[model samples]
Target chain A: MNLDLRLDTSGDFYARKFQPTKREDTLILNMGPQHPSTHGVLRIILEIDGEYILRAEPVLGYIHRMHEKMAEVMSYPQYLPNPARTDYLHGLAWNWAHVAAVERLMGLEVPERAEYIRVITCELNRITSHLLWWGAYLLDLGAFTPIMYAFDDRERIQDILQRITGSRLTYCYYRFGGVSNDIDDRFIEETRKQCSRMKPRFKMFKDLVTDNFILRKRVEEIGEIPADTCRKYGATGPVLRGSGVPYDVRRAEPYSVYDRFDFNIPSYDTCDAMGRYLVRMDEMQESIKIIEQALDTLPEGDYIMPKAPKKPKPPAGDVYFALEGARGKIGFHLVSDGDKSPYRLKLRAPGFSNLSLFSEVSEGVLIADAVSILGSLDLVIP
Target chain B: MSEENAKPEKAPDKEKEVKKKEEPQVPKYTGYDYDCFLAPQELLKAVTKLDHADFFLEDVSCVDMQEGFQVVYHFDRFSQPGRVVLRVMISRENPEIPSIYDIFPGAAWHERECFDFFGVRFTGHPNLIPLLLDPEHQGPPPLLKEETALKDLNQLYPDRVHTPVSPDSEEFVKEINNCSNQKSRNQS
Candidate 1:
């Protein structure tokens, strides 16, 4: 009965029945276009095994609204509003970068009062940007409560900035040679008061999420990008400083009234996602310091250069000007043919380069680790 | 530092006076050398030869010039402040340039974008494919040499009816081939 029931194969086919002679690689899976954790419409195609990722490729341009193309068709003055949409959080920083470039190209001088005001507004915007990032980054790491608390303080800055600039999210507040509006005594006093209030709240931020063990473990040592690799890829801003570069465009080039003010450029050499997080947090404090100094030395003059007319006439030549934006080095390379419209306009967006570094950094990282790595880079994905 | 100097305070209105006293008035800006303006043909080689010449190819799209296609590369130092521009002109028939991917890894994706928008090609690029356009798009590429694209479509397909190509098909095929070759090479 036993002999009749069983039969053994000569090649051990029965022993190897469940095993395949060859296994086809698994197909890559698309992770987002709808996922809230993606920050935006950023989609990542991951080739993974179980939970470990073998390859992670980010698919961008899902939101490429042809901003550059639109910039080409519009006049020089008309293109001012375009930068606001690129990074909605840091719209003013981009607006400042564009105007500063045009001012340099035309060889125009910004008034002392305008310069100080520009610095004050940009620094305040930078604080708001960092605060939003702090809340969003924490939210991405699965903490939900900080955003409302962060937004509560952020809205005050928004209200103050809006009172001066007239728009909340996409404010085009810079002119070719100066700012769109001047800050009155009441506005200056309100900003100064807000800074005093925000300092202790920032301390609360440090205590609340900075020391959370899960947050630290998720971001601290994962996805380490070395300083040299960072330099080669041309990473800038908080990402570059996070790797210990200490190269801030505000210090290096000194656009606007940045040279007149005194503030430390925060940098750390850890080169991890957590290192970036800490650098940005420290940077927010430094921004507040700069704002305080700018407010204390608020000058007396016209808000804009008197020579600049309603329509800008930048003489024929190329001028490349940059500013230290909240994200990184935001610059405008403007070529004017002595016309009302620019001959050629080149925008140097920091988010583009920062996003490119992700494919390299996330090569062997797990899929879960990749999202955390991207959040740490603090990009708006222009 | 200029911050310590009294020149800015002496006369903020005397901008022209300051420039005249600081340096000789040139035909253009004083910092750029007169000899640095390269012809369209020499742009690629000249830029590639500069010391520490990493290209922050921030954006690489083209405009439909009356003469032909003008491919512009917005060059800047990401960490440093210096910036430059390099423009290339290519005929509508075969628009191509030596890929700058070897110089800057970030440029490859930008080059694909140029291809997608303006139909220019980078000769030595590892991937010369469409970036933003849908392959199945029947209408012409949104930002191409409009007349040239019409001419191309007429020559390539005499009939008005044409089958659309899958946008990522070519890229997918090439990636698969490369992966297999890499696996075999690893085995060897």
Candidate 2:
């Protein structure tokens, strides 16, 4: 029962792959497909010389459910609930992107009311996403109380969303032509109360967290990524906005009723962890503004289109539809051959692009600051 | 198209010399920057051109069509936002295309993901390994179709115009040189 054989065999696959690269002074660290700060099933392989990181490579595919394959196999309507699973926090935006892609291909006309409903509900979901990122990111940097404050507001918003969406996290409220249910007066009233309620909370957040000296020191100038680096890696959403190029798909490639709404795309040229942090905080307020404007001009019409195809067979062609999700630009590339099932369905997750830039930015940084930078990316590792 | 749309190619970031609007039959995909089919040899050239024009690679997607693998590279610009979809067809026998990772470092993972699902080899890719697929898992690529399930390119892209492109010209030669000289092709 000597321990030599067992210890040698017990090293996992990543550990085995990393062994050949080991040098005299440098250390290789495998940081979680399970570590709490990772936010999801993502593992980063780090080559470090003492505390400073020499090189870092994020190895993905841990929770690879093969969602793209599922899209090809499932019928048009049967694939509705699956997209939400990719980015659970901003579920509605993914839902809308998928539905909108199919709608564009099939030429289904969505009612004006349905478009407004999508706008209102999607903004509420965006707030929940940013709030979670805010708390979890702060928690990663060694703060705990902020998460409680975040979840407190997050739960109230989820309650309002769950009333119509019928689920708390992974939502499937959107259909091909329109939404599953229409927004009632109670829903609008509750949302208005919640929106007004969140304004003061954001102010409280600024005083309690943003303005704190220690937190500012942790995030302020750490991991500065210039605008040039952002373009090369194709990083989008707040990560791109934080670098000072105002490219929001809602504004850039205006899809749905987003064109009609008036809301600023918040960006900061500081290009550090604090820049990304500030961007999300301001974006949540902007989401509230969009939701309010949408509610004010909510039209009276059918919730779902009358002639929306139950089993859609789009004419032979393909389309690429993108929308502004909370994380970034969520794109759907669908190819059809006039079939009930899609020939090819490629999902362009924003997290994928945002995460790609990590290896380049993480070099020459302290291990702890690397964690702050990763957290600021707000990755939900789809 | 209006005067505004007509001058997209004449914009400072773009070159008016090689606007290859040769395939008049190709229908623009409404909102996109228009589609172009290129030879595998020309794939790297086109990518380099786009990279020099400040267009960033969005994603590298592969579709298993009848003719071969349709390797679609999507790119967009910050200064002028529009999707430039470059579709290159590879033979079914050997699904290989030159990697754009040297031009766009972000394409590394995407190329691996494409390879893992479609068995499409990205030549010159630094570490071409399975991305989403587990290494221990034993089976053919999940997305590859059997012979019976395969559909022809014409059926998949009914609106596609496939006029044969002319041979390599001096204009393209200078375009490739400009991209290579200006941006240092990424090593990893």
Give me the runs in candidate 1 sitting further than 4 Å from their true place: A1-23, B1-81, B84-89, B135-188
How high is the TM-score of chain A in model 1?
0.91
Per-prediction DockQ, in order? 0.08, 0.27
What lDDT score goes with residue A199 in model 2? Answer: 92
Per-residue lDDT over B5-102 for candidate 2, one digit per residue giving the tens place of the 0 to 100 score: 87875675454322432223232233455456778898777777777778877888988877889988887777767677778889978888999888
Each prediction's whole-model lDDT (CA): 0.69, 0.85
Instruction: Determine which window of 10 residues in candidate 1 chain A has minimal summed lDDT.
Output: A12-21
In candidate 1, which residue pairs get closer than 3 Å at backbone N, Cα or C atoms, i.e. clash?
Answer: A237-A328
Q: What would the per-residue lDDT of candidate 1 be over residues B1-188, giving only the tens digit for each residue?
A: 88768766866758865464445211223111111222455555544543244434445545555445666565444444344444555676777677777777777777777777777778888756555555445665566534532223222112223332222345322322232212332343
